[model samples]
Target chain A: MAEYPDRLKDTLADFNFVTTRSERAELLIDIAGRFEPVPARIATRPYAEEYRVPACESDAYVWSERQPDGTLKFHFAVENPQGLSAQAMAVILDETLSGAPLEQVATVSPDIVLRIFGSEISMGKGQGLMEMVRTVQRHARSTLAEQAS
Target chain B: MPDRSSETLDLAQRGYAHPDVLVSTQWVADHLNDPDVRIIESNEDPLLYASGHLPGAVEVDWAHDLNNPLRRDYLDQREFEQLMSRLGATPQTTLVFYGDKNNWWATYAFWVFQLFGHDRARIMDGGRNKWHAEGRPLTREVPQYKPTRYKALPRDDRHIRAFRDQVYQHVQVNLPLVDVRSPEEYRGERLHMPDYPNEGALRGGHIPGAVNVPWSRAVNPDGSFKSASELRRIYESEQKLSPDDEIITYCRIGERSSHTWFVLKYLLGYDRVRNYDGSWTEWGNLVNVPIER
Candidate 1:
């Protein structure tokens, strides 16, 4: 089996110790405060429909650029101002998966949403966040496929 | 032209049966420091309140605060009292609820509060989105209030709530049941939508004899509810439902239906409307329950 990205593993370790919902919410909210949307050079307003994440009510969009070392850097835009969870998720995916080896990034499971957000999340929210992780994995897989071809 | 100065005055002209239950954003702003009022933000997103919320507002999470930790039921009377106490709210405190998704979860919280007979509650007319659009102040600073000694009545599921057996009986008698989900969900097509995941139902479709009235029809684009006459056209004229009818509303998990329940019982002055909180998730999974596509 491919190994998980080291940064993702470290992030999960940090969440593992969250004993209360308020503690976890504070941490995720702080992470969301650091979220930066995709720069204009990559994409802009009225983002292309092709980049939109499916089933995401938050109206989130994603893009990837190849780094100098063949790794991928992910960028995201969450259109809904109240979509704080999506913002936090965008930040986590970009910080941990960007510049990591494609294989390792692809191995990151969607189940990590449960670990990070906890089981109390609504069903629709849980599904939407998982879809975000899947979208990032799809980008990494497609990049690896292009390299192989 | 409508008066733009105060939402409360504007709401009065809309002619809802119980317009006082809905307060405008401006009204809430003015009441921010009113010691008798407690502003509560409830949303489907757990992180929304933590990110930034209305100044002096407290969060009441649907999962962590309302639900019974062990069972699928809601918190009991003791639990309700504890929750109110934690919020520093006595029976006299007026709770004004608002949240994202056009107050979908806010109404759900309001419904749960009703189960405990908290009648002093009001829903912010336009919810969190409208507040944000108006550039209302949002702060990350969490407020701490001295806990109050709150007294709560035993939960009254008999009035505004319905269980599966009652729903089955309602169907048997051919009473009105409004399915407040999307058209696709009402038609059992949500399960097969390309690239979309199932919404946790073993089967698809709605309860037998239900009419599809998608809940959003009650609200305008700005997230404020449509006027009483407009809503009457949808529910009474188009759907042919009567204010005298004993209606039961349900959605995937009863969240959306609570929105409709609020509309019928309060806005249109329907005398008997109950929300089936178990909704499709429970009914669709039950072995012998009847579901119609």
Candidate 2:
């Protein structure tokens, strides 16, 4: 059994192999550049606040749902478009885990979060990135809890 | 009190200590075509500049650019020269810096430039936040230009930056220092700023004898610096800091402190001011450091 979502696994594989600081910087810039503007309806206060990325200094939000197919999808935005710290995490999770199955989402261990974002930022700030991934996984698990009852 | 008119005038009209350091958005809009002026956006988030920046502005990441790859310190003179050249900036070019967080990293960039002794730098007052609020233009197109043969002066930290050891000594002697983090962080209630995740600090609280003056107090809601008189009320009257005292400012990281550093050094013309970049993360993590609530 594949321990990771195919999409998340592929994206992780794509980033996991990058070995240089300069390359990591470029990859982050590439992700930051691809801002698909969230519509106002989605970015409104109550909607955004409910799923906000925890502990981010920037005003960041995320909406996650488990599809009928038992996969997870993510939507996220930060009020400060220039807040790279929050954006880097948002971009990584949205790109990797969107529509990922529960098992694969579970496979997104905190270590993997550390692995993905640790080198990109400094290890000193790795705790926040770890929590960010955990937040996403937390949202994914809620769906399982919903179905359990 | 002979000149009543002079007293009534605001700091902008009466002029700042270094009036040229702040350029207005309208001024930047007018000089959009001036080749001699280079707009640089040094945001805390590199992606912000990539999303949309002012026309012809270059992006510089404080972490990737200013910081040395293998060391804890900033880049040396040779690396700084290359960075300036790559950004299409000549020594004579007027580099205007702006970014998110009300020009916090903008002034951080300015302070780093000062560390390298680059004197031709100015900050775009109000930063990107104010610019966006005003409904100004932002473009996703990142600009490129021919590299200049840049010359970097000798690195100078003597007048501006402070290390943790100096902080310890200052604490013992009870020299003037300002703990510019939030009251909670200063009071040992939290290790990080409110709503910000903890950044790997081992312990909390601040250097003994350091006064808690939150950095946010220096700015207006729109993110511009308050008038000089109002600033005096904060630093001179409230905080009881003299203009000539050797003062050190700090926050969780160095960026927030740099904003206060700029205000003291340039806006109010304080003679001796330094930013303790080692700050809370460094202070809180280190072993055997005395901390106060």
Candidate 3:
């Protein structure tokens, strides 16, 4: 079994203590408040369709830039202003998986969406968030494959 | 291209049969502190209410607050009374519902409330998008209200809701059924999109003898409902549906169908309209159910 990223494990642990719905929502809203979109240095308006996350109603776009240490940094843009959940997911993916080892990042389970967002998340929303996680994993896996080639 | 804002007609001018069932954003803003009115925000995204919502608005999560925790059915009469008490509302209190996705979940919550005979409800037209676009105030402050002692009647599913058996019967009779899903979903094209999950259905396509009318067609680009004439053109003139037709609407799990149900029942004044809450998730997965691609 592949090990999960340390930061992601720690983040999930923090979410574990959130016993109440409001408390969990507050924590996620605080994270969503800190969301920063992909900067112009990486990409700009009219983003390439290839970067768009499938099944995401929020119209989210994902980008990964490789750092000097060979780690990938994930960035996201949620086009819908009301997509607070997508924003929080983006922030969490970037903060926890950006500098993590590609192998560990690639193995991150999308089920962590249920863990972090709670089980009550809607089917459409759960799928979209999971797809966001998958998009990030796809980037990591692609980078690894490219290096191996 | 016509300016969307210019194209928007006032609620009164839209010619809906029951214009009172819809309140404008301005009306909601004006009624923010009305003791008789309660603003409820329901959304698919759980974080939206806490992030920011209409001032003094309460959150009623559809899955958590409305649904029965143990079963697929909704909460019982006791549970409905408890929820109303928690919301600090009474039978006389008017609930004005609005939320994300152009009030898809809002209309859904409204539909559930109706099952309990809570008819003192109205949908905030254009929902959160129009409110935010118009720079209306939103707050993160969750309000505290004294819990009211409320009583609710037994849920009346016979009138507004449709079961799978009822849907099958409706199909057998060749009555009008509107499938308010995307064209791809109606055509069974989205069942196997690469890397995309199936939307909780084993089979694709729509119910037999159902017409395809994506729910979004009832609303404008700004999220507000289109004029009655425009809607009439779509449903009556285009689809050949009559105002007196008994209709049933369904989508993936009944949320989107509720939106269409609202339009046909209230906007077009259809005589009898029922929302099949089981929708495609139940029908598509059912054994030996008729499915048309």
**Tens-digit lDDT string for candidate 3 (B1-293):** 54234136788888889999999999999999999999999999888888888989999999889888787789899999999998999999999999999999999999999999999999999999999999989998999888999999989999899999999999999999999999999998875333334347788999999999999898888889888888888998989899888899999889999999999988889969999999988898899988999
Q: Which candidate wins on DockQ? A: 3
TM-score of 1: 0.94
Off by over 4 Å in 3: B1-7, B192-199
Ranking by TM-score: 3, 1, 2
Estimate the lDDT of model 1: 0.90
* lDDT (Cα atoms) of all candidates against the true structure: 0.90, 0.77, 0.91
| TM-score for each model | 0.94, 0.83, 0.96
lDDT of 2 by residue, B1-293 (tens): 33323224443673468877888887889888799999999876544676678999998888889988777789999999999999998888999999887898899999999998778888887899878888899897878899889888889898899999888888888898988887877888865523234344778788888888888788777777776766777999998998889899998778789999999889889979999988888898898889877
- Judging by lDDT, tell me the better candidate of 2 and 3: 3
Tens digits of per-residue lDDT, candidate 2, A1-149, equal 44876666776787788787546656777776665544565555555355666656665677775567877767777775456656776777787788777656755776665556544453324545566677887887777677678
Error of 3 at B243 (Å): 1.2
With a 3 Å backbone cut-off (N, CA, C), the pairs that clash in candidate 2 are A82-B48, A84-B45
Q: Which candidate is the best by TM-score?
A: 3
Candidate 2, number of clashes: 2
